[model samples]
Structures are given as structure tokens and as C-alpha cells.
Target chain A: MTIYLPIAELSVNIFVILGMGAAVGFLSGMFGVGGGFLITPLLIFYNVPPVVAVATGANQVVASSVSGAISHFRRGTLDIKLGLMLLAGGLAGATVGIWIFSFLRRLGQLDLVISLLYVIFLGFVGGLMLIESINAIRKTRKGVVPVKAPGQHPWIHRLPFKMRFKKSKIYLSVIPVIGIGFGIGVLTSVMGVGGGFIMVPAMIYLLRVPTNVVVGTSLFQIIFTTAYTTVVQAATNYSVDIVLAFILMVAGVVGAQYGVRVGQKLRGEQLRALLALLVLAVGIRLALQLVITPADVYSLAIGGVHG
Target chain B: MKRALLATLTLLGLVAASPAPAFAQALSPPAQGSVVERLEIGMNTSQIAITPDFAGADLAIFGAVVNADELLNSIGQYDIVVTLEGPKDFATVRRKERVFGIWINRHSVTFKEAPMSYTLSSTRKIEGEPGVPPLDAPGIGIQHIDLTPTDFLRGGRLLEDFRDAYRRLKMESGLYQPDPGGVRFISSTLFQANLKLPANIPSGTHTVRAALFKSGKFIMEKTLPLRVVKTGLEQAITDAAHQQPLLYGMASVFLALLTGWGASVLFRRD
Candidate 1:
């Protein structure tokens, strides 16, 4: 039957959007990340405007992250101290990201830059992680003693302004933490992403936060940042439509739960490898678009008035 | 020869069998000897300079109103319509006429003006006071005008605004129902309805009829034949906007960073 979709301004199968939400949710739930990399492209494929997709996706991220965060908290896997620090950095980063977005928009080249960065970052990071994880898994299978604790790099000790992390048992400079925040912020704004994938890894490797805390801290930051992003984009940009966000969020919460469960079953090395590979694949695809002359190119501006 | 004759006769018979209203119920033929009086379609500023690039296209007519003094004075709710008669292109997918009536203000209540002429008649160009006639373009084509931005305005067109709000609320709450065809129509507070073109739309001049109805009666009728040329770049832009906003947004960001990395570096240095 022909159903009129308010968003598409056409009659469509009612299940198309709902099913999309569910599918993305299941995958995201099956995996321990926001399914944005999938959802945004899927929406784009359906010809949803990029602005709406990003804004709506941000809205969905909040819901999914909240659900995931709560579950992790229940498991006592969340490192509240580290999560707070990351949140501080994430918020600062988000504000800066917003400013950068506005400035780039004025120059009229935001889309090209965002795609290029995504392809580059996701591809490189994903490739490295996948390779490393595969090796770790292979070594573990071979009965090699898996490292009991993360290695203490000498540089982390020499960095000025060392502070003790009681839970992580590592003291590190605040500068790197702030820098990490700033970097994640820039990435989030540019790519319209939550920066969770970036955050989790950085927390674990750079800041020496425990692995259990990484996902929780990232989720903590994402919830706040994305929620703020939604309101700002909505009230100022008139881009956020709560209805669209709510629908996706409901599906995402269920998806995230399943994803986390599946994630728990796999060894850390294998999961990292898979995630890293996925990132690399998306990154490479995005990078190619930049190097290649696009089959079609277009530009647009806000046509509708904002409230 | 016999088969060909039979085919022609069969075609004639099929045409004859089509439904026709009884004589008394039939629509009256247009008035006789009516002076053309400088025919022009009312349109929004956006629709001006519309160029059609496709064969057999339909153009939008908007911001039109009938200037009957008697109708103006006795309005609790009144419908204003414009009709396009004579030549037209393409078939109507769906059509609805919009009538916006704002209350006259104290200062303009006593002001009297002559029947508006077709010259400078489009609503956007209306040089009138802040009253009902001036508030809404007296006659608006429901199928042509975009009401989104206007609806977003704080005090623009209240009735349409209210309707849109209601629709949003209903849809969000999951109270809205889809029709049997799976198309759920939330009432539009916006001005335009996109008319879909059939794939096999025939080219040529055809009669275009438009009327405004209030309480199921035609209030005004306007007929103007327009040549169907090609559809404009509007659809393409719309499609692109919907299909790839992130790609567009991200690309914009990438260019900024290329330039902004220097700025970021400079700020860091500072």
C-alpha cells in the first residue's frame, strides 16, 4: 500500500525507515559503536539531505549511547573519573568543532573536507587495528602469554604535569588529555560522528585508561555531546526534528544492547581487529572520492527558514 | 479497411461512453465576449523567470486573488481562486486551492481601494497595508507556493502554522494513520503540494481549469493557457539536498580544514 512519508514528501513503504532503523540498530548493538557510519550513508542512499541526516543521526547517537552507557554502568565497567575528564574534553571539543563548522561553511567546502578526513582516518586506523588484533589473536591461540597489563611507555612518565589515575594506576600529563579532547572534537564536527571510535582507542593507548573504562568514557562523552549537538542544531539550525531522532533512537537502543553482548563474546584482539578493519574500509572509500573526479557534484544552502 | 474503420468507430464509441454530467448539472461554458484584459499569472518571486527544460511541463501559478468587493466585506471564511483555462500541459496529479484571510487592522479598515488589476497582481508585489488583503497574498496556489520558510516565521500565516504544528504532534505521537495506499497525509500548513508528472505525459496545449471552493462551491475560476516547455532545476536540487546532505556537509568541512589548519596552527602559536 502507498504510504505518504512526511519526510520524503512521497508515498513509500512504511517499513523502509523503520526497517532501516532496526537494521542499523541491530548491527550497532551487535557491535560496540554507534551505527552512524552505516545509518548516515543509508539515509544518504535514500536521498535524505545531509544536514538532516547528520542532525538526526546525532540525535540517534544520544539514545543509543545512553542505553549502552546504562548497561555498562550496571556492569560496573564504567570508569567515572576517566569518563568525567573525557567529558570535559569532549564538551570543549564539540564547541570548537561547532565553530569550525560555521567557519568552513562560510568558505563553502565542508562536505569535501569531511569525506576526505573520514576516509583517511577511518581507513588508516581501521587497517592498523585490524592487523594488530589479528596478530594478537593468532599469538594468543598459539599459547603465547597474553600481556597482563598495558605496557608503560617511558614517555608517559616523562611528560610534565603527571597526575595519578587511581583506577588506571597511571599518572599522565593533562596536556595530552586536553589534546586528545581537541582532536576528537575536530573529528566529530568534521565527520558528523560521535568520535567514540577515536575516543576509546585514545583513552586506552594514549591516556593509559583501562580498557573497561574506554567504552564507558566514550559513551559518557557521546551522550552529552550529541544531546547538546541536537539541541543546538535544532534550535539554531532548525535541523533537528525530535520525531525523527526518537524513532531511530528507539531502534538503536535495542541494537546497541545486542551489539554489546556480541562484542563481549569475542576476544579483545579480535574485536579490535574487526573494528579497525571496518574503519579502514570506510576511510579508504571516502579517500577515493577525494582523489577521483566525482561522477556528479553539487552544492546547496539552507533554503528553508529557521525558527 | 474494415478493421481500420471499426477501430476508429470503436475509439469514437469509447469516447462517447465516458461519463458526462446531466445537462442541468453540467458546468456552464465560460462567459461569452469576455475581454482578455492583459492576462498574467500571479506568482511568487521565486517562481519568476521559471524556465522549463523538459518537454510537456506544467508551470505553477500562485499568489492570485479575485477582487470582488462584495465578497471581501462579508467574510468570516471565504475562498479565493484563480483558474487557468485555455492551453495547459500535463495532467493534474493533485490540486488544492488555498485561501488565507487575515483580519483587517484598525488603520486600514476604512481604506477603500478599487478592484485590483491583473497588472502587478502577484501577491509578492502587493503594495498594500497590513490587513487581510495584504497579510496573505489574496489568492495563493496551494500546489505552487512553498510555505515551509514562511511557516517557520514567528507570526506568518497562523492557520497554516497551527495545522503544521498539529500534524507534527500527531505524527510524533504515532497517532497519525496511513491511508489504504500506505500514504499518510498529515495536513499541510505549508503552501505547496508537489504535482507528480506521469511518465507518458503528452505534449501540446490543453485547457487548464482552476477554481476555489468554500463549502463545496466554486467561488472563483481562472483560465489561462500556458505552453509546456521543460521542467526546471528545482527537482534536481531538491533530490540532491535530500540524498546527500552529509556528503555535501563533509566536503564543505574538508575544504575549510585545508585552509583552517593554518588558522588552527596560528592560533596555537598565539
Candidate 2:
């Protein structure tokens, strides 16, 4: 069945959209990662206009983050103070990012910028995850626990404007927290991603945020950031299609449920390895499009009417 | 002042009408015939309401050729070419070039006041052919549609390539369609011209035009105003997004919140 997307102004196969949502949702659930990184790229591949895909992806992340955050809040695994700080930065960053988004769009280079950012970020993150997971798998086979040595009194400890996060049990500088949040906020606006894939590792390793509280904190900030992005994108760009977003959200949540169940049966290191490969695959695919010659060089955009 | 041609049109296309005849004059010099051959078209409705599931629709333009010569009618000398031109807008076409091993849009040309969509239905191939009167001239067929660059001379001499690319792309996108045999002659005086409204047809005040040709010579033409309006949920959504954008944005966020919260609550019960 074909359904018309109001904002995108395109008719797409309903099953194709539903399947994409379900598949991305399952992976996010299984991998414990927000699926923004996957869904935005997938939507672009499906020929959804980049503007619509980006805004809709941000909207999808809002739902997933809300659910993910709720679980963490129930378990008391989140640092509210830290998450709020991140949000403050995220809100400001998102505001700036929208300006950049519109500017790039007017320049007609928004699509190129989106693809380049995705290729760079996804490639870096995927390669790091692959190497780390492979090492972890090797360590487990050798009967050694792969425990990371916690660094104390690191350079981050000397930064000014330091505040204590009681829940995370860390006295971290507000600068890095806000900075990371700001970066994620910009990503949410431009790329329509929750930034959890990057934020999770940053929280765990760079900020030295506790593992238990990291996912919850990241998700807490994500819910608001993506929500804000959605609202702003609609207000400015008017690119968010509620019809498209709703389908993806419903299918994604249902798929995530099954994914969580399957995730329980898989080992941690292997799961990360598989997810890494998936991320790498998506990243590489986007990269190829940039280098390869396109079928049609001349493209048209009707100005002032969805131009 | 272009010319006071005795053509029939409700809207002006560089056509000034005299008291005797009004509007829709072709590019050709006004035909001075002993008997004025006039074309008339009637629309069932002024507006076509498109539903959310509107893929594409066929608009049947029923018209009559008034005062046509009997000899011309008997010998198939009269050819009718009908077209539906969509609302006009500035359409920009961009060309991509490989830069530093990556292809990017490097050049662009915008057609000023170009019709957003166009569908042509004619009695036969308009390009002059044997046994049939050719109506394809400076202002008749799809190829004859007027398209000028915004910066006509600034692009220097490379504007023609952009124009060609624009037409090819539009045709490929199913926006510019030509049906040579779409218009059929039910009778000599009366004809039914079937124009296909593409799935992506722009909603606006479209013009239904019928140009009459007698023995390959241009006569008076006729035009009618047909509004294409998107209706139902699709229209409602588009309106809300543009009109009450803030409210629409809030509603979208609220919906997402509800969906997310509901999912979390449902899963918790399980």
C-alpha cells in the first residue's frame, strides 16, 4: 500500500516505511542505542528528501528517547543535574544549529554537508567500536576480564567551573558536559540524530560518567533535544511530517520490544561487534555515493513552493 | 502593446483583446479570415478537490469548434490542441560537477515565471506531419512552452543547456507530459480533449487552453480557469503547517510525546 507524506509531498510504500521503522527500532533496542544514526541515513537512501528525512528522524528519536529515558528514570540510573546541564547546552546549541541548517539549505549545500558529517562521524565511531569489541572478545577468550583502567586526576579534573554530579559520583567540569550536549544538539538539528551513539562513548570514557547512569543520562537529554529539534524544524523549515513520524514511531517501538528480548540472549562483545559492522556498512554506503558519479547532474527545486 | 488579437481567454498571456474578440492570442500574427473560427471549452467544475490518496486524474475538457469551415471539417483540416498549464513559479535547475573527487551542485539556472506543471493533449502530433495540420509552433506544444532564464544573458550562452536539462528533468519527473492522441474528435464540431493531471501536479489556478488551427494556419484560441485544490487531511495538514506553524509544531511534538509515553506505559504493564 502507498501512503502520501504530507510534508514530504511524496507517495511512498507504507510497508517499506513500516519495515524500515521496525528494523531500525529492533537494532536500537538490541544495541541499546538510539536509532537516529541509522534511520536518517536509511530514509535518505529511500529517496525521502534530505530536509524531510532529517526533521522526521529527529521526531522519531524523541519517541524512542522518551521510552528509553522512562526505564532509566524508574531504575534511578540517571543523573538529573548532569542531564539538565547537558540540556541547557543542547537547547542553546540546537538554536544555533537551526540557523546553520537554514543557511546551508539556502546555499543548496545542506545535503552535501549532511552526508559529509555522517560519513565522518559514523566512520570514526564504527571503526573505534569494531576495534574495541574485537579486543574485548579476544580478552574474554583468553579468560581475562577486559576492565578499563579508570584515570584519576586527569586533565578534565583541572578544568574551571567544576560541579559535582552526586548520582554519577563524579566532580566533572560543566564545560565538557555542556560542550558535549551542545555538539549533540547541533547534530540533532542538522543530521536529525539523537547523538547517543557518540554521546554514550563520550560519557563512559571521556567524561568518566558511570556506566550505569550513562545510558539513562544520555537518553534523558536526547528526549528533550530531539523534541526541541522537531518543534523548531517544523516552525522554521516545516519539514516534519507527523504522518511519517507516527508510523515510524509505532513500528519502531514494537520492533524494539522483540529486539530487547533477542538482545538478552546475545553476548555483549559480539553484539557491539555486529552493531559496529552495521554502522560501518551504513557509513561506507553513504561515502560511496559521494565519490561515485550520479545518474543525473541537473536537479530542480521549485522556489517558494516546497523549494 | 503586443497586439489586439481576437482570441478567447479569461486570462492574459501577452494577449490584448479587442471589443469584438477577447484574450488568449497565439504568437502567430492574428489570422484575418472572412469567417472568424472560434473555440469554446466548458469545465464541469471550477475546482478539483484532490484527496489524500490522489495519485493522478484525467481531466476531460469538453469543447466545441464554433464557426469552423465545413470544407476544413470534412477534410480533417481543423486540428485542436488543448493544454493544462499549472501555476507559474521560479524553478531553479542545478547541475552537479565533480569537485575534489566528490560531486556537488556547482552551477544553477532559474527559469523566471515558469509554469510548475504542464500537460498537453492534441488531436495528433503537433509537429507538422502529412495528412494532419501541425499546430506546434512558437506557442503550441510542450516544446513550444515559453521558458526564459532569470539571468538570461548573464549565464551567457550556456542557458540553452540548462533549459534542455530542465525540460528533460521535468518530463522524467512526470510533470511535463504530452499526449498526441489524447484528444479525440467525437464529432466534427465537438471534441473531447483528455489531459492527464500528474500525481505531483501543483495545486493552483491552472489554465485550460485550446488553440484552433485551420489547414496548418493559426486561428483564435480559448482558455478557461480551473482551480486544483488539495482537500481532506492532506490539505488540512499543509494549511496548519504554513498558517499556524507554531501550533502545528506543538501538536506534532505533543503527538510524539503521547506515542512515546504510551509505548513506555504499555511495555511496563507487560
Candidate 3:
């Protein structure tokens, strides 16, 4: 039994925390998920203040992305221009998301709203990816060129200011790209996440960005958004514990390197399936909280005795 | 003549038994009491003086445990309560009741004046000088023996003001200021009592007594017979901090990096 001290009450055993960190860090590195989904729930289970846990988990995303970004940079997979464009949109979206969060919270419906959003988004995205991946595998086995559904929305094509994405081999209007970025940012701010999982799929399927650039750009956006979150929380709320940040950063970095190596051996379809499954599991958990009668009521303690 | 002789004999007996009552009474530790002992001296005494002395603040008296064998091996505890008497110069003086050494799962500081339980940590001649260290750091320091309630003073408001003043003094003294360290100990486990003088406080000797109480009773008491001079000693700690701001800042950053990096390395699998 590990006896956690004052701050550690919500902190698991160092070994366990490290293990969890490593797992989350690895997944984040390979698939570009922020790992907030895993870290926040675990912290809540350990009895950390819900708000603090969310903010702190977001802070660690910055570190997680740093390690993955380095690997992608080294592999010549980074797309700086694309990354910057997404970041610009992400910042604007994040500000909007925060505003929406406060508004919902004031209305006493934040939890319900966020939970509904998670289930809808995750189920839709996961199902879509599963089907697309299966189709890709089938086409590959038959030695046939895979057919993709054409994005025939006239407005998406006719919007003003068409721009070139050399790496993605597409010239499309910048409005949709910026809109996607802003929408992801809003979700990121509300959920206290890096928005990588959402951004990756959007870039690959919707924006038609190349796979190589998707992961790198998603991580790039994560880095900037998380950094912005850190500053905002620190200055306004004093919620960022540099100490806590450092601990998670260390674990996340090492996990990143390992994830990259393992990711290299795995097939892309398999990795995507695993990512989808993970997101689905989290989505189900969030949805259950709404309909299920809680097993306990009149909670006993404000803080747990030694996490 | 017979009547006169009888009256004279009665008068002689009264004088003979006067000292018996005084000798029979001995202060004993209560069933669940505790004791704490500190030495006290005159207010004008030097910070380095190592001799025992008597001191009074607002006439608040304190006593030290010169001979406490009766409390040495008792079954019940002898929690100690130290109080400063006389001048109410500091806010801690009002909370004279809260100052004490406590046992586990005990009630708040006892209010009764019964003998309390105690364990002797040390005994020494309390030195008053320019460089005396803080008493709560768990070390053997100055010692004096007195039983006065007004000798020491502390309060929450006072502590806050003292901290602010200390920070300003450090700044003025060319000392560095950074993040104040985290509170590692909780209230029941440990507490601090610091005395501060208002600007109008007399610039002369001040007497303070540290008293020990256990289970609501006074057990062992000690007096800090030191003086409040024109110079400030608490400022020294602030100055040291301000003088090394870089060291403090780097320490904070290093701590962050170490924990962050360590978490990364420890969690990484080959």
C-alpha cells in the first residue's frame, strides 16, 4: 500500500504514476492523443480536486508533445507552415471554448453538455475511421486503387482565399481549415485537452493532408495550445504547479521515445483501430455517468487519506 | 498566672507548625497531562548569554523545570504549555493558551492548571544575541526557567504582517525574494510563535517566559529572558534570501526539471 502525503494524496505511487504516465505518453507519441482522457480520470480516482486535475493534465500535454515533436522533426516529417496555420486557428478556437465552458458552468450544465459532446464526437469519429481503415485494407489486398468519397460540398470548394498545402498536395480554401482548427481549439479549451486526437483525423480525412504531416502538425498544435493554457492558468488561476509539470514532463519524454520505436513496427491500420477503441472506451465512460445512478451518495471525505 | 501561661503556650505552637504545610505540597502531573520546559532571562540580556535569569513581560511570569523527576516515568502524558506574561506586545500573547507541546489525538491545548505530562528534550542557558536561530527548527538552543504567561506573543494577523515586513526589510537590505517554500507540516503536528514589536514599542529590554502545560495544567515552564533591541534579527533571514534570489529561482526550476525528467526516465521502458 502506498501512502501518499499531502500533495500526493491524489498522486498514485510514484511507480504507478510513472507507469501510467509511460502508457499515456507512449500512446500520445504514437497517435498524437493528448492523454488527458486517461490522466484526468486517474487523478479523479485518486481524489485530486477535479478542476486542478484537469488543468494539470493539460499542462503535461505540452511536455508529451515536445518529445513526439522532436522525433517527428528528426524524421523530416514536420510541416511548419501547416502547423502554424492550425495553431493560429487553434488559439482562436481555444479562447472561444473557454468562454463556452464558463457559460455552460454558469448555467449548471457544463458536465452534461461536455459528456454529450464527447459521446457524439468519439462515436462518430471512431466508427468512421473503422470503416475507412477496413476499406483501405481490402483495397490493398486486391491490388486495386482505393476510391475515396469526393468532398463535393460546393461551398467548401468555392469559399474565398484558396491556399496551397504543398505537403498535402491540395489547394483548398483556407476558411474550412481555419474553421476546423478553431472548432478543435474550442473543444480543447473546454475539455482541457491537447486536441491531437480530433485534429489528426480531421487533417487526414477532411483536409486531405498527407499522413506524415498529420501527426506532426497535430503535435505542433498541441504544443502551442498547451503552452498557451499553461500561461493562462498560471497567471489567472495560479493552478499550474511547476513541480507537477516537471514530473509529468520527465515521464512523458521517455515514454515518447519508446512509443515512437514501437509505433514504427506496427501497421497503420492496427494503430488507428487501437486509437479508435481507446477513444470509444473513454466516450462510453463519460456517457455512462449521465444515465447511471451513482453507486454512492453523500461522499465521505474532501480528500483521500494518502493516495 | 495560669491563664497567661496557657495563652503563651498556644502562641508558641502556632509558630512551630507554619513550615509543615509548605513542605508537604508537591506539584504532580495530572492523569493525562504533559509538560514543556524553556529557560527565560531578563529582556536586556545578550542573545548569546548562557545563564538562567528571571524575566517579566506585562508582568507575565514563566517557569522552567529545574527538577522534574516526578514526571519522568509516568503512564499518562505530560503535555507542555508555555506562556509569556506581562506586556501584550505581540498577538501570540493573547493565544497563550494555544502554545504547547501535544500528544497524538489529544484535545486542543488544555485549559486547566493541573500538572501535565512531559518528556525532557534538553536544558540550557538561553542566549540572547544578534544571531539566535529560530526555536522551532528542532534543535538544542537557549534555555531559561520561568513561569509567566505574557512572555511570548503570536497571532495570525501578526504573523502575516511580520512576514510582509520581513519581506520589505529583505528588499531594503539588498536581499532576494522568490517563492516562499511549501508548508511541509500541518497545524497540529507543528506550530510557530513569533513575537514582533510595534514601531512605538520601547527600545529596551523585554522579558518573556515560555510555560509548559499538559492536560490543561501547567507542568514545566521556561523564560526567554532576552531584550528587544533597536536592531532587527528576523531581517537577517530575509536578507539571506534576497541576497540569493538566483539560487532560489534556479532551485525552483531545477526541482521542476528533475521531477519532470525523472518521471520520463523512470516510466520509460527499454
- Candidate with maximal TM-score: 2
- Per-residue alpha-carbon lDDT of candidate 3 for residues B154-258, written as tens digits (9 for 90 to 100): 335544443343323322322111111111112222322323222222223434434433322444444554443322322332232245434433333344334
Candidate 1 C-alpha lDDT tens digits along B1-270 = 553454345434433554464432212221233211122233322221212222212334442233222222133222323322222111111111211321111110010111111111121212223552321333333222222223223343543443344333322322221111111112211122112222122223433333443322345555545332223343343334345544433332232223223322332343
Q: Write the per-residue lDDT of candidate 2 for residues A115-219, one digit (tens) a residue.
A: 897899889988987887788788889999846633444877889998999989988899999998888777766665676777776676578775557766876
lDDT of 3 by residue, A1-307 (tens): 2322222212234566666667777887788777888887876675554555665666677777767766766666667777888888888998898898888767763555575778788888877777776766676678886465545456678888898877657788888888899999988878777767788878877887766667766776777676666556544544444434555666776787677667656666566666677767766776665455554211211111111
Q: RMSDs, each prediction?
A: 20.0, 7.1, 16.6
Residue A141 lDDT in candidate 3: 78
- DockQ of predictions, in order shown: 0.03, 0.39, 0.04
Model 1 CA lDDT for position B254: 33
Q: What are the lDDT scores of the predictions, listed in order?
A: 0.47, 0.76, 0.50
Worst 10 residues of 1 chain B by lDDT: B108-117
- Tens-place lDDT digits, model 1, residues A174-227: 667777887887777766777777776677667766555566556666766766
Of 2 and 3, the candidate ranking higher by TM-score:
2
The weakest ten consecutive residues by lDDT in model 3 chain A span: A298-307
The candidate that wins on lDDT is 2
